[model samples]
Target: MARILSIVFNPSVDISCDAESVQHTMKVRTHNLKQYPGGGGTNVARVVAELGGHAELLYLSGGAVGSMFEKLLAAGSLAGHRFPIADETRISLAVREEQTRREYRFVPEGPVVTTAELQPALDFIADYGADYIVASGSLPRNAPADTYARIAAIASRTGARYILDTSRQALKSAVEKGGIFLLKPNVGELESIEGTKLDEEGATRAALAIVRRGAAEHVVVTFGREGALLAGSGGVLRVPARHVETVSAVGAGDSFVGAMTWSLAEGHSIEEAFRFGVAAGAAAAMTPGSELCRRADVFALYEAGSRTIN
Candidate 1:
């Protein structure tokens, strides 16, 4: 099996629960508490592991909360490469309302990372001979916006496929620098990157425009409810979104990238991988707060999609 190295600059401990109703000046009793190791790369690695793939996590860890994060990762038996720092990792919370089924999420900006602390992860990637290198999530505070671009250069030198999922300047800088094998950007992100408005009809053209510019070999433009469009040298392929009762939207994007990358690494066609990604994302959305897609749900959704396409 191919090994995947997932990098997360700022990882966290995800805490989730359910409350009867949320009111401004009242104490809302909660139940069904669950905690998971989180952050983009951590979530991606977890999904890969759930799908029976070998994934190695590379993330920054420190502080008491960071120690708890390490314990959570160990509980899942995930192989991790920890980068030491002085600041404690952040914690994110999600509270689901039983009455309205609405989820409220509180996310904190993670620790500020200095160049010295950030350099080791880049150095690790330069030497790591993994089949795929996935850098997911937001850049830590004070980290260079060109962080992903630097990672792209290393991937180019080492001959590993680079998969990027991020937004804003971090994403823009990377795409501008080029050498990304696969880029998963949502519709709004594509609009931001291309600096234009994109409707469904214009989505494929916009994605292809990114490919033609040599920014990325393949671009997947994901529409929250409208599914995704995959554009590459082979042209554009559309994968419709699977209709499922919404539970939580958190981690769906990461699940999509993780499943798609794992499927592609397992020798599936790009189209097939896209379908798997769609299914995995739907599966993630079907779960309650903070929890990712279950393996059984992912396979079940994938099989259902196969039937629909066939």
Candidate 2:
């Protein structure tokens, strides 16, 4: 198995519950509450483990809430190396209103992280190199915009394929610095980077431009229900989205990245890996609240879709 390492700058304890109706000035009764360790890279690692792949996790945590988060993670099959921070890890909530079939999410900006607290993670990445280094999620308040850029540099020096999934200044800075092996950006995020609304043709052109410039070797733009497009040196390949009843859309993107990475690490072709990613994403949507893609569902979907594509 190819060694994989996933890093999360801002992690969270994700709490989800369902309520009949959400109304102001009323005590809403909730049930089916679930809690999970969450963050972009954290979710990626979880999906990898779910698919019988091992990905070492590196993340920052602190305070009482951090302890609670650790317990939740320990309950899973992943073991991680934690870098202590001075601030408490944040808690995010998602409430599903059964009446409207809508999910409401409340997320905090997260605690400020000092350079001192962030350096250890950088150092760890430098010393503990792997086949692939996945840096996902947002930078905590007060972290440098060039943080992911610096990580890209480290991945280059360590001879690891760097995969990045982020948005805003972080994404811009990293792409500007180049050397990314794969860049996964949703349509909205791609639009944010391009600074304009892009139709499908415009989106393909933009992704190819990035690849031609050597900013990234492969660019995958996900369009949710419309499916995803991959642009690389070999040209663009489109994977249609798997239509399924969505229990929760949360974690679907992470599931895509995770399963794709695992497939790549297992020596599958880029096209095969892309198909696995789409399958995992659909499987994740079929699940409830913070839970990622299931292994059996992933393969079933992948095989079924493979036949359709064939």
Candidate 3:
């Protein structure tokens, strides 16, 4: 199994409820109500684990919610935790309304982690022999925007590749510091980084700019149902995203990045890895919740998706 370390700040207990649709604010019935350990890095770690890879999740956590977070991860077969001394982890909820085709999300700002607490999580990745460090998600208000950049820099020093996925100022900060091996950002995220609107052509151009600027060796743009584009040699390769009756959009991007990382770690080409990523993302959308997509689902989707793209 490959060693993959994921560092997440602002971890949370994700609760999702699906109603018929978001027509009226009336008592929207929930078909499913479940809580899981989630956040970009955590989701990536979980996906990696399901794909038969060794995953070690590192995050800032403390208090009762932190304890619960630990307990939740412990129930699984993953590796160690780098627990910090904080109060309780916050809760993030998603309300899916199929009628109106809307997903109403209520997310807390999450707990503020001290710099004192940040080191252990960073060191955990370094000491754990991580082959790839996935430092994703946002930091709390108290932390600097360059937080993930700092961690990625550390990983580079230790000879570990860094794959980053986030948004806004933090995303910019992460890549500038180097050590970013791959980047998976949606159209919106890409546009934000490029400081422009990301239509189809714009999205491809933006991804290329990131590669030109040397943000990462590979930059992937996911366009939801439209598909994805990879900025690679000669030119950017376009891979059609698999169409699915989307149940939940959350964790879809994480699944894509995780599968791409898995393929890259296995020494696949950029185009091959990007196709696998597209299938994985579609597989995630087919599932209901955050920890939904399984390795088997990804494999099946990949077979069909390969044909769809070719």
Best by TM-score: 2
Worst 10 residues of 3 by lDDT: 77-86
lDDT by residue (tens digit), candidate 2, 1-310: 6889999899999999999999889998999999999989999999999998999899999888889889988999688999999999999999999999899999887878999999988999999969999988998899999999999999999999998999999999898999999999998889989999999999999999999999999999999878899999999999888988989878989999999989888999888889999999999999988889999999999999998984
Off by over 4 Å in 3: 19-31, 98-101
Choose the strongest candidate by lDDT.
Answer: 2
TM-score per candidate: 0.97, 0.98, 0.91
**Candidate 1 residues 1-310, lDDT tens each?**
7769999898999999999998888888999999999999999999998998878999998899999999999999999999988888999999999999989999999998889999998899999898899999999898999999999999999999999999999999999999999999999988888789989878888889889999899999999877888999999888788889878878899999999888988988888888989999999999888888888989999999899874
- After TM-score superposition, the amount by which residue 13's alpha carbon in candidate 3 deviates from its true location, in angstroms, is 0.7
Ranking by lDDT: 2, 1, 3
lDDT of each: 0.91, 0.92, 0.78
Question: How many clashes in each structure?
Answer: 0, 0, 4
Residue-wise lDDT of candidate 3 within 187-254, one digit each (tens)? 88877777778678878777787778777888888888888888854578887778788877678898
CA error at residue 130 for candidate 2, angstroms: 0.9
lDDT of 2: 0.92
Q: How many backbone clashes does candidate 1 have?
A: 0
Comparing 2 and 3 on lDDT, the stronger one:
2
Give per-residue lDDT, candidate 1, residue 187. 94
